[model samples]
Target chain A: MSVKLTEDMLKALPDSRGHFGAFGGRFVSETLMDSLMTLEREYLRLKEDPEFQATFDKDLADYVGRPSPLYFAERLTREAGGAQIWLKREDLNHTGAHKVNNTIGQALLASFLGKKRVIAETGAGQHGVATATVCARLGLECHVFMGSEDVKRQSLNVYRMKLLGATVHSVESGTKTLKDAMNDAMRDWVANVDDTFYIIGTVAGPHPYPLLVRDFQSVIGRELREQSVAQAGRLPDALVACVGGGSNAIGMFYPFLGDESVQLYGVEAGGLGIDSGQHAAPLCAGRPGVLHGNRTYLMEDENGQIAGTHSVSAGLDYPGVGPEHAWLKDIGRANYVSVTDEEALDGFRKLTRIEGIMPALESAHAVAYGLKLAATMDKDQVLVINVSGRGDKDIHTIAQLDGIEI
Target chain B: MSRIEGVLKALKSQGRKALIPFVTAGDPHPDETVALMHALVAAGSDIIELGVPFSDPMADGPVIQLACERALKHGTSLRRVIAMVKEFRETDTETPVVLMGYLNPMEAMGYETFADAAADAGIDGILTVDLPPEEADEVAPLFAARNLDPIFLLAPTTTDERIRAISEHSSGYVYYVSIKGVTGSASIDVDEVARKVAHVHELTALPVGVGFGIRDAETAAAVGRVSDGVIVGSVLVDTIARHQTDPKALHQALTDLLNPMRKALDSLAQ
Candidate 1:
């Protein structure tokens, strides 16, 4: 099932009311509507302004080291014996991930809005470190809410955030993971709406956020498009990215939405497997419901309570996906798939051994699925997978899994 | 008139303020919830706000979050909560019972089905914590068609425009969250609350009930002095949590907790 990729269809999304079809409305309390409205208006005005775009571009070039190379994984393609695979190296960014691109954009927005303080929620701590990095650069107060469970697991990133002059709050709530951190952050934003700006890490949250985060992160796909044309001389046959709140995937997919020939595949965390009921593949197994200020696909029980999600990667262990992903799934524009932890571990090892690149476990989901997809296609077919982040933060988890103390 | 409106009107005619007590259904035990409601009404609760347990209550603080967790452990759900209300209405139909919860459960049950079932089970009104007026368009009409009051919340941070918009859509009464924070977070200034309640009154003719910081009788009475109703939640829910293993003790503790606030509110009117 294919829908026509029209320019108007892509541009008119999230409407004036922040809805993407029946998804992505402002489902927050009245206390939050005013701030959201203010943000939407300011973002709309500044998004078109030359000064904002120039500053953002300059930072991407000088600070974040933008135009990251789309490298051809020649050895992996030969090993797979099928399609040629290309890697969009977002892993090479300043904070070792694509998360910094978004934090930088939002921190600048926070400064423009005259907000002295910024708060964010994170699961893997990449976003937290990125937010802390940008806040330190801009001299704004930063607070990061991480689930207590993640705090214990991702201690190195926690220390890095603190060293960068940001306070790390360990939230002890329901399930004590990404979802809980988000709840705490939302509560804080509601309480401190006067001076604080909530820089949501992913393309989830309520309206304007999904749209804003997508626009800010779209630098990935925009660059990918030009590089693919210059390098491969045409768009790749397929694009693959792992989905965790879908920021990186949407960033990589948005600019190419109009390219009807470029097939999009979003891989979700399949923990054990989708049928195991422990995975975080909401679009594959869950239904639509309201959560985290947006109506989106969610892993909820029959009684409507959010179910606990499991994934080897902390970043993907959330029960809900971004609303736009839900819309994309509904419209049949993007194919949503999954990779189990075992398969992702295999992908991680294969990439490291073959390409000398240790991909983040979250990104390995895409790598894992990309390999299978490549093996089914002709050798001339090119596929680009978003290497969204590096694996330095997951070394401890990997070592522990392999029975190494460190 | 609906039960909530009738109760508010009756209290207004008597020159008295309403003291609403809140308790999560199936907290101590599911079977004991009906008795607890009876005890609250008998101890001078003009209305009962029965909390339907949800896994994630973002607007709630530690006390109520724990209450929700405890209730969820017992497998309490929206349907079970309506059943509890049905049992309570068997003997006492005079006091209004409002279902207080988050929106997901209702959305899961289907809005029309939930509204019809709620009205059938003797629910007078609903206060969905996260469903602001902007997103309440679909469910609001269903609730109204069932004669159920679709209540909304007004926070300290709510702007004048939003206040008027909420007032226009809200029925029965508007809940004035006295603090900018979540439930059971901090103390509120009585003078500031009086000023804000006055502002709310000026915008909407609906009676404003103040909540979210009234932990003791003095604070409840102070807020009740300015608002038409006083809602005491976390404190009463905390008391129930303390005596959760003993249903009789929980009932006695709830009565002891609310009786003082009831007397304080009545004394204010006097």
Candidate 2:
């Protein structure tokens, strides 16, 4: 499953069978084969249709508040003292995260498929809120599976989901985290495959999911490309985004793949540190294996059991990454790194204090790494970090860490 | 012929539907697995489908998930499960053993190495729940090279064309999942399974073994009348969960649960 693809093949990848050089094929049970095939077929047709594209574009403008600003972080740039740091303001999106981009697109696909019910697996509740928001708008029944641990930590988001009229199922299975939530959602989708549309929260899962999610979320990079040229007269020197299941990072990285000059970096959560063997950095420290549905880098024990991962951010607490990121890392197209929990918290604080903009803890990982990378560069060079979500949902976690009553 | 083929053939000739019992390896304790295997054979199980516990069994319900956790708690690994099979093979070589689980463990071992080790440890067949026919194209030949029957599953949603495709790749009996959901989910519609099993028989000569939702002797007997074999799980694992404290009660309870199903399957003999 660890085969490598040449540079040219990476451009037209996933082939026909969804293999990104031995990753991202359909590994689901036989029951799901037909539904997935149908989804792939419909997605292929709709992605090319003019009307579908127009509606999606309109929804981005009218509903999701698209073209989220690409702002120059003047203060952070001055603080870094080496590079001109810019922030892709995905945090300003309607649902307060880049997750809405993919959810709205998938919700439209679900409606196109005539599916009345939608199911989604969420880790930090951001995706759940985003998905529920779309389902409410589309008049579809929504079910969101969340790990029990995350449900407790992200209780505010859980209430937000309920207020949006989505049923939240607290998954108590496995480690009670993101991977188990995905497992439970898969089971639910299998049982109700006829009526349910599984809106995967990331750029992971089986073939069409990674492919479709990437296509939907690629708006981030597409917009950033135009925004970069308009703001700085050229593409930025580098692009940085945090990778939980690699959705936002891949979204920000896809359109820039052909731009040979713009370097890309993906930041994975380093709970303690990579050397501590407790982080969720699969690309850095793990091996290639099948989990969920695609063959990607996974954090597994010697016996192939999925290992438990630790990250202060629930969204980044997954065992496997998107297969495309795995391909990107293997082919030397992009760089993958990890930032420790302490560093991410520091990034969270620095961004809020210096820039007056709070970032989701997941995005703070990229901010944290970007700060280090910026400091090592010349002041004339430019770097852009994707602030993928607002940190309002993380206030409880931050307060608890600081031992504050709030 | 492979051991799985031989057993299914003998059962077919005798007009007796195969009664396949499934148990997770090292459940309760690793030391007790071999004894449980022997007890299952003594209770007239035709073939033993031993589950290799996985951390994330997305296809299984709570019963099997808890069973996997129990097995893993005792440090059960793929090699350990294979070693347990070798121990079972020491005395009883006739009853075929089929290793069943998710693909990652076998994949971690590498297909060639896993195939070699499994064949050496007396494994006759492999049923990776997550490896559909599309993805099995790579690993099927590796298992085939080692004469390990690569078993595939047929879901209710599987079309006739797919049934042919899956049958072409499968060497041993193709398991027909009786329901649409995970293991231990919803009751099986006997008539619906009979129709699907009959459809499968028309497409391929591979024996159809019905599983998932088979709980009692009556359900086993109903399903046995249509398919060539009946695979029982979850209920037996639930029993093990109940009697986990006492080995004697565990053995007795296993035998007690399997004995009636065995008799029910045998009663269908012409």
* Each candidate's DockQ: 0.76, 0.86
Report, for every candidate in turn, its global Cα lDDT versus the true structure.
0.92, 0.93
Among all candidates shown, the one with the greatest lDDT: 2
Which digits, one per residue and each the tens of the lDDT, describe model 2 over residues B138-223?
78888889999999989988988899999999987999999999999899999999988898999999999999999999999999
**Over 4 Å off in model 2, which ranges?**
A1-11
lDDT of 1: 0.92
The residue pairs in collision within model 1 are none
Query: Model 1: how large is the Cα RMSD against the reference?
Result: 1.1
Q: Look at candidate 2 and tell me the lDDT of residue A224.
A: 92
Q: Write the per-residue lDDT of candidate 1 for residues B7-110, one digit (tens) a residue.
A: 99999998799999888888877888899899999899998999998887877888988888888888998999998998888999899999999888999989
